[model samples]
Target: MATKPEGTQATRETEAELARFFARYEPAIMKLGQALRAKLRQRLAGLFEIVYLYERQGSLVLTYSPTERGFEGLCSLALEADGVKLHFGRGAELAKADPGKLLQGRGKTVRHVELRSVADYERPEIEALLVAALQLGNVRPEAGAKGATILKAEEQKQRAARRPTAARTTAARTTAARGAKKAKKARS
Candidate 1:
């Protein structure tokens, strides 16, 4: 029977490599995740992408970006084994960090982040994922059909619907207050 994959990156045939990586690092790696989180303290917010850096049994460890703030995802990578994991920064921070640029200029351990723009996504490396998102409508829909007009119309309709009820409520409250005042005057 085919087994579930270990934590290594998967393009297609790397499943076996993943299994090997898991076999090499499994139980110890889980503890590594705990250690990483402890190091980050609670900065482990959930805003950024989490990345795991891998080396040969702690040879060259590097983290690029993580989805969760702090080291949450990084710890997950550590816990999983398939490879080494250390917490990187948030996704935006990672991108802005220009690990690739740093590596290029200074021969940093991290190197060459793959920058995929809307145009660059047409490349083979990303085409499949792009197609999947397209299928899922993850990208914005076309103009006109789901454009700003629809949103503006909905907002206008909501405002128009609210106005009459708000006016009626205000009028009712005023009338009730006036009636109460008249009764008090009569009593006086």
Candidate 2:
């Protein structure tokens, strides 16, 4: 993938948002995720990227599509705490294309291959799967069109605040009562 010009505001924001997303995972997983994403960008140069950061689930997903909707994605990269997965959106259609049964998942629509490193993406079988997926999506990479990224959603895990103990609550009330008494006395 060509390096995006650093001066562009959109590019800077996208990089920063992605950086924050990667910060949630372990170093090794984060590194693998970055490498996998770079390889995907290189392989699918002109496809629009729709990103979803589900921090509550500890997963970050990037879907490459001909259009903006993720449901229209040709393929997706799912980065979780454990590792990364390359998901073929139309895996059911590509089952015959993958005679080796490399793709996992029994769902009717999607199937994925667990990716350990960037090199896994370069494997012949995976490359073939990608090409087949593109064809299935009926998308051809537009010449000289480096796709833009759209951050669809970010769901950060919400931490509940600790409730005050009964003793603390009582003490607080007592303090407030004493202050009120002192104020009344002063006014009198």
Candidate 3:
């Protein structure tokens, strides 16, 4: 039997942790997230992959940085219920880099592109944006160095509260009103 490499077990554990984190999302969304992550790992070769699992928000954020600190992340893949977003950490500062105006966000520093699939990330424009994001962040990954996945937080299984739909909101109000009327009649 061929012995596994030293880091093979750790890599498997990391993948398993990510699999658990992605279980709540739709299959398409999960696939997109994985694709994006694979692409990032390939492109940002020596950068550290910092994973943040937000159980309450029902999201998994994978950030790439030269160091382990998340704040130094050049880019991130934010996986949520609706879709996957490619976030440029210093987007606002990369004004000249985004000639196509592909980025969308009103924030001061961050901007993102909603990725429908890996093809979106492979676009020349998006590739340029990724380069710009890294340049702006001043990340210099050592040539041929392998990056490792760093799980920033332990898994928290708390489910996020879904937004109440209009019908649900109306039904809840009606139910509350009926309860209030019943209490008033009982008091009388």
Put down candidate 1 lDDT per residue, 97-179, tens digits, no spaces. 33233212123222222322223323443333323323332233332221100012233346777989999999999999999
RMSD in order of candidates:
22.9, 10.5, 8.0
In the range 1-188, model 3's lDDT, one tens digit per residue, is 11112269867877787798877799999888887888888899888888888866878999898877788899899999989998888988876788888889989999998999889899999989888877777776666667878876552322223334656899999999999999999999
Per-residue accuracy of model 2 over 1-188 as CA lDDT, tens digit each = 22234358878887897888888889988999888888888788888888887755878998998877788999999989889999988998999899778999999999999999878878899988998998887778866568878776532222212234656789999999999999999999
After superposing candidate 1, which stretches have Cα over 4 Å from the reference? 1-150
> Where does candidate 1 clash, by residue pair?
48-66, 48-67, 48-68, 49-66, 49-67, 50-66, 50-67, 51-66
TM per prediction: 0.21, 0.77, 0.76
Over all chains combined, what TM-score does candidate 1 have?
Answer: 0.21
Model 2 regions more than 4 Å off? 1-7, 154-188
Best-fitting candidate, measured by lDDT? 2
What ranking of all candidate models by TM-score puts the best one first? 2, 3, 1
Report, for every candidate in turn, its global Cα lDDT versus the true structure. 0.34, 0.83, 0.81
Q: Which one wins on TM-score?
A: 2
